[model samples]
Target: MLDPKLMDEPARIAALDRYDVLDTPREPGFDRITNLVRSILGVPISAISLLDRDRQWFKSLNGLDASETPRDIAFCDYTIRQRAPMIVTDAHADARFCDNPYVIGDPNIRSYAGIPLETPDGYNIGSLCAIDIVPRQFDPGQIAILQNLAALVVEQLELRRIAERDHLTGALTRRAFLGEMNRAIALFERHQRPASLLLFDIDHFKQINDNHGHPAGDQVIRGIARLCTGLQRPSDSLGRLGGEEFGILLPETGQEDAARAAQRFCETIAATEIPGTPPLRVTVSFGVAELRSDWPTCESWLAVADMALYEAKRSGRNRVAIARHDASHAT
Candidate 1:
């Protein structure tokens, strides 16, 4: 059992957020590890489970039909609270799990073995677990194998974190941003959840570079990224789409709210002086587009947003333009 006094919940969640793996589509890299775990351990179920705020989301699940379970009812929840591997030889005989729903009902988990997927910074973000339907004891050799596999899972997560972020602004790279947009699209398709995109770029950015030099432009970009990152919610994603251009994906947000956010961003950036040799003030134009049921792909959605951005630039910059649902133009 984990001691309540030993846990720093907020810091742990922040560490997990740095990975940016939540709500992402399953990848072959993770799926392969889960598959290997099931095969090597001879378990009916093996999963790479990440503990979100209220749920234990499966990054990869082998032999499981469900994608997630309530955190309170998850066996992996306990695994993440301690450094050592958590093993239950018989769930029915254990006081902690005898009344668990998964133990008594579906899956009938009789045995379990899990290793904590600890980040390099020492936060236990989740677990890699091997589950069995029949009571069994895992030998020392088997535990060692599971531990090694869990390390591989953490390594993959670290690699993804490095690959997805921009080197200068620490924002999501263009490719990773598009990937996140696709994931949001999938979520909206499945659950009809409202989401919106905001595309913006620094107004007269080339003039700033030419007048003040490229170093000044780089500082301005970093400043804008920091400002937007600070303003966004935990669920929102900020990305560096290209030179002087950035995109923000606001999950569960509508066009109206997103436009308001973009307006705020525009006003804030225009008012603040970015730190440099002489300091620089810059304005930005914004395009806001909500996810539409008719849009079939991420590219279509992005195109609409891009059109709206062009409208903002045409309408005198430092303003927000909302894309129409018809995909024709912005208002």
Candidate 2:
């Protein structure tokens, strides 16, 4: 039976989601820690595991063949539910894991030690675990080392979260946005998946800053970001591409769908009254560009979208423009 705490909780799930590390490619920063842990602990397998809604995903698996396992059967699940490290000397003697598939079948986990990867706000998002195929007791000094290593994992997560987001609007920073775009481009190149980019900026943003104080301008920026986030799908990524300009990367979407989304954002901004002392109103222009197979780089893809944005501003602000195959624009 699963622990009661393992049941889905909105706040816990949200806390895990904030790190945005699930399903991401392995990085050396995490891989190094897992490798070091496995070597130092003399364990065959070491993994940086994140407990998601239904599965335990491994950010870095040193010796495991599988990347994830069901949450109900995950040892890391039990580890994350407590503050202290969980050390099991023998899985066969433990009723909780005696019948577990991993214990009964391949990899036959006999000994396990895990430390909860607790966030700064006191949430245990996941665990750093070391697994041995043979039964062995983990000494107090070994547990302490594992606990210290887990802290480093948490620090890495915090650093990544800080580096990826814009300070004011809470959107992806320009560098991070482009990095995601590059990843999307690689995915498209590998699997021929559809993706699109929507670049937009506030109309007469300078005038707003000129009329109202800088604080009001900041509020407007935050408001626009919130609106865009609310309108976007979970797969879509919104990024603050400097100043009043923002970009949204829509995976598994085409040019038409991206243009429609941009149109919705454009209309919404024009209609909604931003909260302020005077309750300011604003409008925005948008440019949509679909990822093409022939594009050489992410910058080329961005250049097309930027051209479309220039066309929108040139024709008239507060409208959506799409980039075509021939470098022509359609509004």
Candidate 3:
């Protein structure tokens, strides 16, 4: 079995998530580095691999047709464990890899080298790797070049993260979230495909901090972030929108479906315990709004949702409210 300890570390996994690079579209910066690794090492295949819980996903691939593979048979998994350059001189002669399915069949990797990609906070997220079908020795000088390329990958990841992520909850920031919402809105305009917005506010959140402490309050915030993230679809996005509030952008989702999702969140939030608190459970009020052909602008989309959220807050506390055409005009 693969090293269970390295694969299960939450801090390292979370560090990988903070980069927000997994399953994201290819970019030239990462592509260029993979290209450089291929050239520098004279390998047939190269990739920028990001490790997730069950799979090693490639953010950039050159000379490889596949996008991902299971973690158990992944050479990159071993590379991530040591956070160093891991070179398998000859997979056919090595006990650890000789019978591996990948080597025995397609891609037929015989020699492999992976340089670990590190976050600034010191977690090794994944690797920049070079693979060849023929066994060979790795020159020390070539390995140094591969390490430098790995550094460039890290630099790009950190830059993308700072610009796109919220520092507190590990969700997208308000600006970034709305930026995506705007694109969904444009898609709605051109294609008439429906998208829904869910805005939720923690019920009685001030008491979390007042009764416990600021540290406890922060734990609650992070917990809510995790809960909402677990409830979202692959294409859906969850984001922290200022204090005590979060936004979910659900493209190709309708109002009723969004409400069902919000209800799930309400139930989950109430049942969840804050990591640092003995009895602190959170309840949230939701404002769900779907795009309307009659709506004038993107600003109106949020306005409608915010008004629904206000109604949810006013009606009781921990319930969901939907925005309708008539409701949009209501004070």
Candidate 4:
């Protein structure tokens, strides 16, 4: 049995969450790593593993049939605990794993070598390992190669974070958000499926910073970003357009649906309480525009949405307004 203290659940889990890699679509970088491992080491199976709360999930697998299994039953779980690489040249002879279910059951591992995949901040999120059905010694040269490969995998994950995520808030950054909007536009053009854009900004944000301080204003921004993000479906993309402003791209959504979603965001933001903050609440204004062929490009569509947002601000804050494009094309 593994000692609970060996795994710092909170730090490790937080580190894992920061990458945002769990259950995401498989990428070429990881697949390439596992394939190289299998080829270079002459191993039957190789995988990049990530530890979630209870499961050891395979981010990449070559010659492995399973996607995930119990963390207690995973070799990578034990490997992640070690600062140095873990090698079990003969599983059946090792006291730590001799009677382990995996060794005695399916997969029937005989030898294994794992290099811990450490985050830049030094959290061991998981491991990159090669498995063999027959016992074999893992030389220092081979172990070094595994270490380098593990670093490459972590590098790829970090690159994804820089490209897709905003540092202050967990929302997508402006450029990345626009890329998502463009992709949605391409899909709409191909299939003529309904889609919409929602642009919004916090009301009286300067006042919050003046009265409560910039830190409180930052907390408020993060709170609202999470609020809008949590309300959307997986297909939707929410982004921090700029300070105190955010945009959402809703795929397969029409004008009415977009309006309702914007309303929910407005109401939710108004009613929610910011934890560990001073006695202050915030409100937001929203503008929605459904996809239209006449709008053509993503920028053009966003311009229309921005116009609607201007209208919302012109009338009053804390309300949802629809764009002329959506109103004209309402179906």
- Number of clashing residue pairs in every model? 0, 0, 0, 0
> Quick one: best TM-score, which candidate?
1
| Steric clash count of candidate 3 | 0
lDDT of 2 by residue, 1-331 (tens): 6544444467678888888777767789999999999889999999999998899999999897887899999999899888889999999999999999999998899999999998887778899999999999999999999999999999999999899999999999997898788878877888988899999999999988899878888999999999999999999999999999999999999988888899999999999999986689999999898999655477788888888898899999899999868663321
lDDT ranking from best to worst? 1, 2, 4, 3
Q: Write the per-residue lDDT of candidate 4 for residues 1-331, one digit (tens) a residue.
A: 6545346779889889877666655678889999999999999999999999999999898997877889888898889887789999999999988998889987889999999998887788999999999999999999999999999999988997888888889799887787677767767877777889999999999999998899999989888877777788987888998899899988889999899999998998899987647845789999998888878777788888888988899998899999985543432
Model 4 spans with C-alpha error above 4 angstroms = 1-7, 166-170, 173-237, 240-261, 264-331
- Give the Å shift of residue 320 in candidate 4: 6.1
TM-scores of the models, in the given order? 0.84, 0.75, 0.59, 0.60
CA lDDT of each prediction against the hidden true structure? 0.92, 0.89, 0.85, 0.87
lDDT of 1 at 236: 91
Clashing pairs in 3: none
lDDT of 3 by residue, 1-331 (tens): 5545455569889888766566555778889998988887889899999888899999999998987899889888888888669999999999989999999999899999899887787777889999999999999998999998899999898787787878778899887787677767777877888999999989988987898888887888888998888878888988898888889999899999999998988888888876765657778999999888656465778888999999899999899999877755753
Candidate 2 segments exceeding 4 Å error: 1-8, 175-196, 202-223, 226-236, 250-254, 268-283, 290-304, 310-317, 325-331
- The per-prediction CA RMSD against the true structure, in angstroms, equals 3.3, 4.6, 9.0, 8.5
Best by lDDT: 1
Candidate 1 lDDT, tens digit per residue, 1-331? 6655229888888898888788888899999999998999899899999998999999999997988899999998899889999999999999999999999999899999999998898898999999999999999999999999999999999999899999999999998998899889988989998899999999999999899899999999999999999888988999999999999999999988999999999998999998988698999999999999766478888899999999999999989999878874331
Q: What is the lDDT, from 0 to 100, of the residue 267 in candidate 3?
A: 84
Model 2, position 36, has a per-residue lDDT of 91
